[model samples]
Target: MRGTEPPVTPDGRYIVVRGRLWRKANPALDAEARQTLVADLMKARRAVRDAVRIRDDMSLRQARRSVNDAKVALGERGPVWWTDGAPDLNRRLARNTIYAEWYAALPEQP
Candidate 1:
């Protein structure tokens, strides 16, 4: 897949670019990394929602990139999941640690 531009969903209602799950829950996406992630998600979301006339254009790499972006965004560096400062249902996870942990164990960079 060269440039699906957006790895759309099956029904076209949402995009699964990354585990960030872009659709209705899309937030302010305040950071540079978050912004980039949001951009990728939007592309995938549009692909599903507006991909008509064409099919099978998105590549797995793009989809994975989007997902990674989201994952990073979801991590602590992106935003706090809640204002209460608690790791509850609506709390955002810690970023620096999460990101570090993710790569620290990696055998090599992709």
Candidate 2:
């Protein structure tokens, strides 16, 4: 995966790059809440790895759900953290939009 950190929109609600949009992390989350979510995410990730190693389908499915839930809580997936109705663009990569020039200026990912 590319490591480039996309530029945030003027309002700071979204990161736009290559004409795609990504919701920023929830700024309203308290430090404790963020920490707890991170812990849950890490635990789920470990569970996934262990399940794969053991070739356990049930465990893997449960672990994947947990991972998704954790990500949603962390504002990394699911609904947009912002309430403004800006469409959710969690995973998009295309061209021709307001931010195209900015995206073009970004250094290419290796």
Candidate 3:
């Protein structure tokens, strides 16, 4: 899993990894909504962990869906937040994109 707090671009609108851009969470999300979604996300994550420990495949599948739903609600998935038409690269491996060289050259985040 990626860190809960990913590094944001200097402008705070995008996540910056190896100089590549990924749209950040929706700024339009109000505080209460954000909190609720985050809580749901955490709950789902805990469910996933529990399911894994118990080796319950059905529970794991359901928990994974919940996690994805929460992420979508939180604007971490789905449509691009920016109007520039940049491809959504959330959860993508750096080596798969055009910025692979740049990503490889940059030092790992501390």
lDDT of 3 at 72: 82
Give the candidate number with the greatest lDDT.
2
Instruction: Show where candidate 2 strays beyond 4 Å.
Output: 1-22, 94-98
Model 2 poorest 10 in a row by lDDT: 91-100
Residue lDDT tens for model 3, 1-110: 26645555444555655445565668889999999999999999999999999999999999999998988887878775667776667656656765567566756765
**What lDDT does the true structure give each of the candidates?**
0.42, 0.78, 0.75
Give the alpha carbon lDDT tens digit for every residue of 1-110 in model 2: 26656677666766765557776668899999999998999999999999999999999999999999998998978777788887765656534545556567766734
Every model's TM-score:
0.27, 0.76, 0.69
Cα lDDT of model 3 overall?
0.75
Total clashes, candidate 1?
Answer: 7
Clash count for candidate 3 is 0
Backbone clashes for every candidate come to 7, 0, 0
Q: Which consecutive 10 residues in model 3 have the weakest lDDT in total?
A: 1-10
Ranking by TM-score: 2, 3, 1
Q: Give the per-residue lDDT digits (tens) of candidate 1, residues 8-33.
A: 32323223332222332334445775
